[model samples]
Target: MEKIAPVRLSVLGHPQRLAVFRLLMRRFPDRIPATELAQALNVKPNTLSNYVSALMQVGLLTQERIGTSLRYGIDMQSARETFDYLLLDCCRGRPELCAPTSNFDLNNKASKKYNVLFLCTGNSARSIFAEAILRQEAGDRFNAYSAGTTPRAGLNPFALEVLQQKGHDISVLRAKNVSEFQAESAPQFDFVFTVCNQAANEDCPAWAGQPVSAHWGMPDPVKAEGTDAQKSLAFQQTYGALRNRIRVFASLPLGSLDRISLQSTLDDIGQLENGVSA
Candidate 1:
């Protein structure tokens, strides 16, 4: 069996490499293109190449060629082995202190799946990304939707490209005005998040459920200019910011926390640093 070694530790020791690893883990079992990875990390292609090579050499990451793209993914079996190896002799046979994996219930049931809505000014990029991220990450526990104060004619192509590269299904997503949800027949939402500054400050229709709302302001990637590379990078950063915040939000214990605590936690998640770790 492969064991955790100094080499693997060294490979992950670099902050950027570690960040890359975490990003891949967020999309576990799915692979993303190398170009997309570089864009997401805001690193030069050459620099990302070096990091990927080092990680792959230590059996931490795997790559495959798909058409003209090189897709990268975490080596889950190797990762699990490494984690087990690290905890093998932890706490000197005291299982309690070691916190053995089996000690915790992995099947705790949530009371119900929550309905969530992501809002923005355009519903073309930031809100779109948030909707996709939350749906993909917590579909079993949340019904995710997105809308705009002033809907765009269509989805942003760059947003679709970035989401496609990350293996998210973009076929059914569309830009719609928030008035659609304001109708009495609309599904009652449990949570509502505004993912851009303009939407957060706008006058919103009163939701049926009076959903707890919070603002998670992220830069508008659709407005990014310069070279194609720069635009792609901007989209990637926006996607990353939404993915991280959504991940944190999805992990909250909704069945246990009261409304005040849940609202506080939601606000805290919104306060997380945009496009970077909080």
Candidate 2:
């Protein structure tokens, strides 16, 4: 085991190999296809294959055939073993000496507040719902903001109705372009989420501070078919979905998770069923 630890460490010593490992860690439990991994890392397929092969050889990664293409994910047990060996054995059992320099103790009631932005294509419905819900849920701990790629002139009436029905204040809600938040004077966001498929795929402007991002895509309530009653029902369901996800998000123990683990948790939160809370 002692001999193997160095081999594992050496494999991750290279810059590109380390990047591959970290990316897989952040996307844990969701195996990424080779093509997607290559494009994300901006590395040639041939070159990435070699790096992937090395990590797999060291038991740090697992691969499976998803149809014709190969998908890769981190082997959590193996990664844990590698980390344990480094801290418990190689560091002479003094784990305290190996602690990360930066502190991650973000208390929910602490003065340290995080800026979060929720995005959709129109800024009229889903993103607005998220901003209001998160504000209602954890306003003191998080500063929630919402914006859109190509924003509408005003807020969706049904969206506003549903929010107001739920006792959320709607007077301050207004549609804003994503560019407004991208300005230099804009608050540095700690997290950003895309609540619609279109906004998730759009080429968004580079944000200041490079916030952690995830896609929480849900149906556009504004596009719901049928009568006004049915349309309002759609908005109501969207509200429940966003609230469900936000509740779990607000409950997260941010102090306990490193950046990679936090990102993985955020991704998993996105996969939560519409009416379910995790």
Winning candidate number (lDDT): 2
Off by over 4 Å in 2: 1-111, 275-278
Name the lDDT of candidate 1. Answer: 0.79
Error in Å for residue 82 of model 2 = 20
List the candidates' TM-scores in order: 0.59, 0.64
Q: For each candidate, what is the lDDT?
A: 0.79, 0.86
Cα RMSD, each candidate: 14.7, 6.1
Worst 10 residues of 1 by lDDT: 100-109
What is candidate 2's lDDT per residue for 1-278, written digit by digit as tens?
78877899999999999988977765555677889788878899999999999999999999999789999998999998999998888678786788544333343323578889999889999999999999999998899999999999999999999998999999989999998888879987878998876576455565655577877878899999999999999999999999999999999988777778888889888888893754
Tens-digit per-residue lDDT, 147-260, candidate 1 = 999989999999999999999999979999998888878877778888875565443445654566676778899889999999999999889988988998888877688666
